[model samples]
Target chain A: MREVFGDFNDGRSAAAHQVAVRLDTNGLNITSEGAGVLQHWPYADLRAIDPPHADAPLRLTSRANPDARLRLGDPAFVEELRRKAPHLFLRGLAQPNVRRNAGIIILTLLVLGLALWQGVPRLSAPLARLIPMQWEQEFGLAFRDRLLAGARTCQSVAGTAALSQLSERLTASLARPPPLTVVVADRATVNAFALPGGHIVILQGLLDKAQSADEVAAVLAHEIGHVRHRHPTQMAIRVAGIGLFADLLTGDGSALAELAGQVGGMLLLLSYSREMERQADAYGRDLLQKAGLSTAALARFFAHLAAEAPTAGGGKLLGYLSSHPPLEERIAVADKDEAGEPALDAAAWQALQNICD
Target chain B: MRQLRVNLTLMDDDSTPSEASAPLRLEQRGRASELLPVVLLNTLLNIVTLSIYRFWGKTKIRQYLWRQTHFMAEPLEYTGTGGELFKGFLVVFFLILLPLAIVGNVANIYLDPENPASLFFPVILYMTIGFLIGFAIYRARRYRLSRTVWRGIRGGMRGSASQYALRSLLFWVSNAITLGWTYPWMQFTLFKRLMTETTFGNRSFQFDGSLKPLYGAFAKFWFGSLFGMLAVALLIWGITFADTAVSTRPDFPFSIAQIAFLLAPLILWIGMAWYKAREINLLASGTTFEGLSFRMDATAWNLVSLIFVNGLITILTLGFGRPFAQLRVFRYVCDRLSITGEVDVAAIQQSSTAVPSMGEGLADAFDLGAV
Candidate 1:
């Protein structure tokens, strides 16, 4: 009988027993040098949980008696067992590390492929939405800060009030409105974006080009649609999930915060998928219809954006439009026959236009 | 105008044989056939998992590399696990990273964007990251050392990571302030610190390299860099002269002057390789583990061709051939490094130093470990 050093596990929760372990033709038999009883583990009932690392300890538990275990102090005994009964010692469990057998490789590929392709895609959206509202709010505010950092804010009191009235009017009609903060930036980029939570940023250039309050309201409604559906939050979740996966892969913890902090920038830069854009558009139409508003205003804004898309020479404009391309298909969808009240009266429209004053 | 290749220590080995006829003997026992499947499987897994399998992938590679590389015909063993690494990463992500992100974002929201004070946020973030990276490298080195086992005796490293980080910070600051002149000093000291801290069972490694001999090489490269800049300027002038004047001549397409001018960058590359090779050689020669002398015989041309050819193949294959590249570098290092004197394995007992609970989390976070 070849002797090996190991720790024996009794049925009770006692201190580990230093024991002399021997593997015979019958099974792995253990004699406790300092403990109360001797145990015999048959090979059929013995199951080994191999150490994840090469130099770590190996644990063997009994299927016959769950509490029975033999913790190998030195894993060299395992190699000896593999040599003795090549079928019994299974840390190679099957093929050793990862390369000796083709079956193990195929199994691993199947499992990981399933986890990534189906798992990530099926889970990213719902998982993202599951994040608490408070976290999403904080996430949105941070992104907004990063976006408007070093840029001038539109601070005209009357124009601000006029803009607030329009936003409140549009959001109040919805069944559930996410907490929204709409601000006009004093930059000349014809764009508007919705951040996670309920933050929206509108460039002064968008305001400057608006022919009427309806056009501006159409743009605002579209942005509000994004917020209402928690698209930004979902987007943030996807990014965070990807960030988490990447960090896990690399074992880098610092990027956790960095990626979290970039949610706002990602929102600004990563264009929503075509399906998401369509969904947002559909949401916008319903919102406008419910608010006694017209889709014609949205169509007109798209028309103007389509025209400006040709002259997309401006650096900021390129950034804005590249992220939110004004598709001809989307413009056509907005050209619905539905009509209702004008977005604002003449004085309110004038005030809204001068919001960046 | 800057090219950044991953900078990593070329691993050295001590074979299992004691009696040596060559004073020092080095050998590589890794078969390309044995490693090819591992690399291919890892590559496949990475693609399927969107690279999430990389931790495990890297672990497998290390395990193979360690097992195949014999010192005196006895292969070293790597004791690290992918699970340990993954757990460490998850802990850092949850405990340190996520909370920090939330706080940072909230803080940025309150900061005045128009104020110059806000610029400090990014600078502070970058600096903090740098510091963390230094700390991470220290810890990762400790983990790697602690996991290295030869003939049942484990190699270990123990020192304060923050102290290492501080020393590294000082070196980096000095390097910056001196316009890169302090690099050799910084590298030597840093390497010395690492070696001095390293322990194998009961023995300790010593790095006795001085900064003086290294300066000649550093100065040579520094002055060579200046000359390279001047040559580049002249080359541009020549190119412009050729563009304007040489087009008129149909028969003189191949001029000796232009050909020599075009080779200036190659000359600079050669100088850079020479400087690097010299520093590495000096470092290897200066290091001793338990009274054993180390040998390194690498040349500028050897490194230049290896890196250049490896790079060309990697780029051409679009990274599919990375396993071969990795294998080639390992073969190169194994072939070039040798050790004198014999290790008494029977004298060294197994160290009871409990393995570190985690692996290279912060290093992974900082992206400090190239491999």
Candidate 2:
């Protein structure tokens, strides 16, 4: 019989007792120096509290006396224990259920990724449409008022008449024109925005940059296209949906979750907006042709922008041309001049130019 | 590693030399080299799994650290599993965060930012988050305690987590209202609450620490910070004056105020660390359990250096050397801490507190798990 010397704590005291352990078919026999046989721990009930490591002592605890502990540092004892009971060594990746767990985790990730990518955008558009038109209009009006609170708004009577004339002419051929609220603001940035619920903002800079009234009318037509498609409301819904889904999956508003939501939201919105811009361009051209305005005005304006600076209208959060499809591509489709009348009379055009004076 | 055996009465005499009844010491047997492979593997797995494997990775690390820590010549054991942590996360995600997020988003859509009434929902949201964070800290501590076992007897914490969270929220509000003067009292009260409820086996710990010992250090910290801010403001004013009055120090490329601005955070951190060391020492010396009284010998310089070096190691290695930094902390604490008084181990029985089925969900989400 091979006897192994070790330390035992019987759970009764803090004292450590030196004992001699002998391995047998039944179990381990522990004997104190003066005391006779102390306890018998069956092999089946034995468990290693600390996973066996080369540098760490093998600490053992048994089910019979759960509070009792045994520490065996001898290499031979470890070898004997391993040979007798190899099941105690299974840990971490070596566990039998590792493959099953990995499979479950992979499956979960795929489902989550697919849902975020395909589910959110598809759902948000329909959800946006479901919101009552009255509520949407109220929201858009409040949002627009707050947005333009600091900017000076130009309300010249002659300019207003000219603008109304141009707007009526552009929408005259539509089966049912939208309830548009157009405002010209005094700002030095060349941009126009189509806000939710048919709110259109024309910057003074855009009027200054346009070579003719036809160019200004072309931009207005594009914004009207956006209003027709209800793009602004859909975009707001998309942002909210992505945020909610990211919170659902990642939880905690953690950095990782926030990053995933932001990057995913930006990429999705960019592509969706690019597609919306293309649609608006096509719709705007059709509107111009139907209204007898020059269809090639918008293309010329885009070419002029491209020639001036590729990033002329770039600024944080409100970049007009940055997120749009390349100007060259847009210009390609609208560059051809079809024989058409002027969008406004010469006097009306001059009045419109001074709209933001 | 040397232990001195003496009668329990020896600790009563303050006049007697500390060497007469040497306190018990903790030992750290783990090495960074031993943990390097495991941490590296876990980090790699975390990236591959989109951090889904982090719960398991944390469990593995805790198991190793627990086993390496030796008290009374026996190693501690960790019984927590990764599945419990994952379940906890899923529960919090679905039941709490998801619903709150949806409501907040919906409210944002409907609410007008220009309207004063719209602030109500946002205020509610912030308050709820604050309360949840407090709740998370208490529960996380409870979970850790329940999983920590020594000599087959589990360490446990007793007390209602909700009450603790309420107290935490109250302290935060009080701190803000008092301009942070109530901070020392809050720390002492909270630490006392935590320590008094902590148990090793069936023997509950007692904390007699008061706010008195903390005020002296806190006063110095407060005054020092005030002066630092005043100095910074003066320097800024000087820089602004110099900018207006041209040709003053034109040879010098950078303003003195700019340099002070850059160094302010570092100096402030050092000062905070100094006060923190004092706080830790006072708190530790006030705790006792089963006739065992503890003491910590943490010094300002040691703590500051430890923090600086650990930060450097983690940052320079791109976080791959996190285990090494953790090891340094464990070693530092073990080397400085000591215990006195005789332990009646026979009296301590297995703890009866029920182990929490789930793990640190909110803590993980909040990134407050500093382990």
Candidate 3:
């Protein structure tokens, strides 16, 4: 029988250690002489040689400088060893052959394909439904309703037709009007929600806090961008589909309710895609310029909001700005524009700021 | 390959009697065997209750199996109250049954007339309505079950109820278009999505879509059925021919003919079973996990024989053979299919330690035990 041995550990050992060697022969009585001192070792005490075979019996002999002599009289041991040699060699060779990251890319592609197959067609109709032709009118009506409600609740209103007309003219000049309906809430929580179905609710506190009309318009335009893209609906569908898919695959519907409850909250904090935000910004600037308003007003407004609340806890409004470019970056973009015109004439600016009243 | 002969000689003098000592008894404990009885009993209880005790029985079965099969001795505790399941089932049942009953009643009253033209439309309408209701209930129950379990894990469920309803509708529509053959594949896809989304103690379960076993089973069923039909046909033909020949020629003895006729069926049946057993062995022989491996027992043929005999008896006795068939199949699968190699209670306990929560771990252990 052919026997091969390789050092299991790197050669740093100082002491001689007796190693257990196992040999299988076909009914062969094999005896060894001059193999150095023999030690009695139980089969169980033998160190596992990677893959252990139960049928193999191992024996321990001395590790000394000696010429070992082996006598094989019994034919059984020799035959058994010959028979098992091939399998042993194959196993030894297979130990080091490992595949790295072979499945990851394939699996990722498969998942992506499946997602698109399930999600794309379902997304089209809702996307189409989001864009509205009369966004300014809708926003006007919603704002008026909120103002009326605030008036009933003993909150002061600074309602003016000139402000609504200016907003209308500004939106009409845009390539694509923002779909969000503006609702001014009476509370001063400095929060706004781009709700599902083009409903944008802005707190009066936020309006009151704004130093310029451009700042308020910037916020409104961002929310309008969210509505136009139907982000909330998309997020809702994605979350629901993910939950359903998970349940179907694992047959474990374990945390589905928690997922459901988080959907609305997550939507409220929804981030629009970067492309959508960029498109909205470009559209808003173009609309302001066409309406004879200075593009720098948008920059000035952000500067005021940033300075007034240096450490604005953005958690509540993060979703509204999720898809938009960073505020500082957008402020820079607005500042680069040198349109020689006032953002709003004094009367329009005053009227716009008090429209929530 | 040369067959190897291993010689184990009993050496005397300066040695202990190793050969006389019972062959190294490898004690195996905490195996799935321990949990089998629990699962079987639970299944029996579930059957007895007409599935009313399904949730509780399943929970108990899972707990027992997990505890017994896992390396750890963790106990699984149910945090979910039975009331949730009860309420869920009630809602599901009413949702499905009420609409169907109302439609059936309406059809019986309005369209059951000697009016033949009204029959087609009402029947179709009733079926459509019934389908819708069944689909709704199924979705609702699914949602409820998922939500309830998720709540148990302290995670918020985030999905619209309407979306779930729509998904249910879409699933049915797709399934209907594909007929029922796509059912298994759809189920697999759906299951994969669901499990991937769920997390427990930060680790998520993954679905491995290995359909080899199912395909193997299907192949066996088809071949077995074909062989069985052929065998029965041959037996019938042989018996009739032999009887006719014996009657026609007095020189050809009746006893010989009768013996041949009887032997024909027996031989055919035995051959069929032998083929089945061999197929089962081919499919199951090398299943291994961790350090444990299994070999299909040859006794599967004997089980098949017993099942055939019982089935025959049942048919002969006009449907009275069901209990015997059930008992035999159960006993055979249990006794013949077993695992071997390095499967100890300690290993099971050790394997379970990595599970997140004790309860969930135990549940997993039970599932393993059942497997």
Candidate 4:
């Protein structure tokens, strides 16, 4: 009989016993000197505890004797067992369901990619529309307060009247305008942005830079367009959607999830959507035309901005134009030469310009 | 010479070994070559499955490492499955993390930043996360122990994870208030707590060590950090005022001091390695189970070289060589550790502590434990 020397742990104790194991067609015959077959482990009941390797032994246990372990150090025995019980070696990616597993994995990845690329944008607009306008306004006000915590709000009486007058002129053309509040912030940056809930902030430096009242009216019209379309609400929904998607992808709250959120936030902020910008520009132009104001001033303001500083769209100094549609594309939209009334009188314009003082 | 055959059921009747048995040393039987192929395959599968396969991959690696580790002439066994880990992660993701995320998002939108009352939200958030980390460490250790088997009897741990978390949180607060001077005491307390709860089958592990031995190494590390910070401040001062002060006198030794200041971190790291080696030795020597006590012979130079090489391997391979790095750590520990006295094999019965149905979800989420 062909026999192999091995060590056996009986599971009841931590002691190891040297034993001789003879392999037969039915099972393994474990025996010691002067002892007839102590136990028999059928080939069908045998399982490898560790995968077979070149250096280590093939550690096996029987289903019938769960805790008892037999380690065979002989290479020939492991090679022979491999031939008899091929099912033990089929593990990990080499299993019979490997193809199905791989297919399912690939399909899942494809679905996830598609959902992120198309589902978020498609779902966000309707989702944003479903939110109550009152709640959005409240949330937006709170957000604005948080964002502009230390900044001074510009509040000259005549300047406030002139600003609301210009905003009303643009909003009056709409069938149902949002509750717009056109406030001036006493900040030195040439920037203006519309917050969620109909809040438009025009900075003092923009008034200082504008040569005439028409330029200020043009900027106000642009902001009113953003509010009317509820672009900020849609943007918030999309950003939140991306964040949720990232959280799901990272399993639980991890550093990677936070990183993904930050990256997605930066990308959304830096780009701000060219298509959305175009919609706002087109709406602003239509508003200008309906209000009987000349679009020519907007083009002139952009031209002067381009000529004075070619680096306007690239730095923080020109925060108003940074990440805006290319100057030429915007200028082309507002380059019409229609004759119209000035946005405000000379007296109101001077008062508006000195609002920060 | 006649061989004696012992039946599996006969040893359950309490035939204990003598307390004065010879000392035994643990041996590592794994080869780096054997581990590499599995790790490489796992990395590829992780990419293919977007890391969803990592649970299985980690289980496979643990299985291999456990099977190759030898104690008292028999290899250890790991019986954990990938499905358990996956289910655990899913439960934590849906139950714990989702609600917290919703609360956080809502709080950010509504809470006024300038209000002192709103500070409660952030403090609560950090506290919850810190507590969860402590809870995860305990549960993770418990899970690993329950899966580790020797001669068919599994290891286990008893004690409340919540209690551990609360104690750890208290220690963290103490550490901050004391400017990290209480770190050695914190480590000793935590380790003692963990060891007191550890069990192998029916036998319990005990940690009997003093706090005085740890203070010497900790003092060296603490003073080294203080001096490193001082050097950094001096270097910054040199850069800011050197133009005016040193330019007037061309023969100043400020340049030499500048170089020394730049090299302070390297010196500190070397000193830290020495302290780490001493700490490990002390901790290992203090652990006892039944009649067996452990001793580890670790040196600062060997530890430093091992860390340097392991770091190099991990970085050079872009983390694919992590299994190899872990293999080196296991081999180093096994080679250095010596066990005195033998376990009374027959005296130990199978552990009856209920095993966790799932695995270490929070640990996976927090990226805790190397192997």
Output the number of the TM-score-best candidate: 2
DockQ of each: 0.11, 0.17, 0.01, 0.23
* Alpha-carbon RMSD, each predicted model: 11.7, 6.5, 25.6, 5.9
lDDT of 1 by residue, B159-247 (tens): 67898888888788788889988889888988888888888876778888778979999899989877886787777667657675663
Per-residue lDDT of B10 in model 1: 12
lDDT of 1 by residue, A103-132 (tens): 444554476446544665567568767877
Docking class of 4: incorrect
TM-score of 2: 0.80
lDDT of 4 by residue, A1-357 (tens): 578777776766555556788878888888765555668999888877876677777788999987778878888777787787787677666764455556655665687667767887677678878988887888888777777788888888888888778887887888988888778888888878888888888888888888999988888887787887788887887777666656555553224334555675556544555556667777887898899997777777777876788676435444443557777766666665675799999998998998777
* lDDT ranking, high to low: 2, 4, 1, 3
Q: TM-score for each prediction?
A: 0.64, 0.80, 0.35, 0.77
- Give the per-residue lDDT digits (tens) of candidate 2, residues A206-304: 988899889988999999998888888988877766665555454433344356557766877787788888888888888998999888888788778
Sort by TM-score, best first: what order?
2, 4, 1, 3
Off by over 4 Å in 2: A1-51, A58-77, A80-94, A138-151, A170-177, A188-190, A208-218, A243-265, A278-304, A307-322, A326-342, B1-23, B98-126, B220-247, B252-272, B313-324
Worst 10 residues of 2 chain B by lDDT: B7-16
True contacts kept of each: 0.08, 0.19, 0.00, 0.26
How do the candidates rank by DockQ, highest first? 4, 2, 1, 3
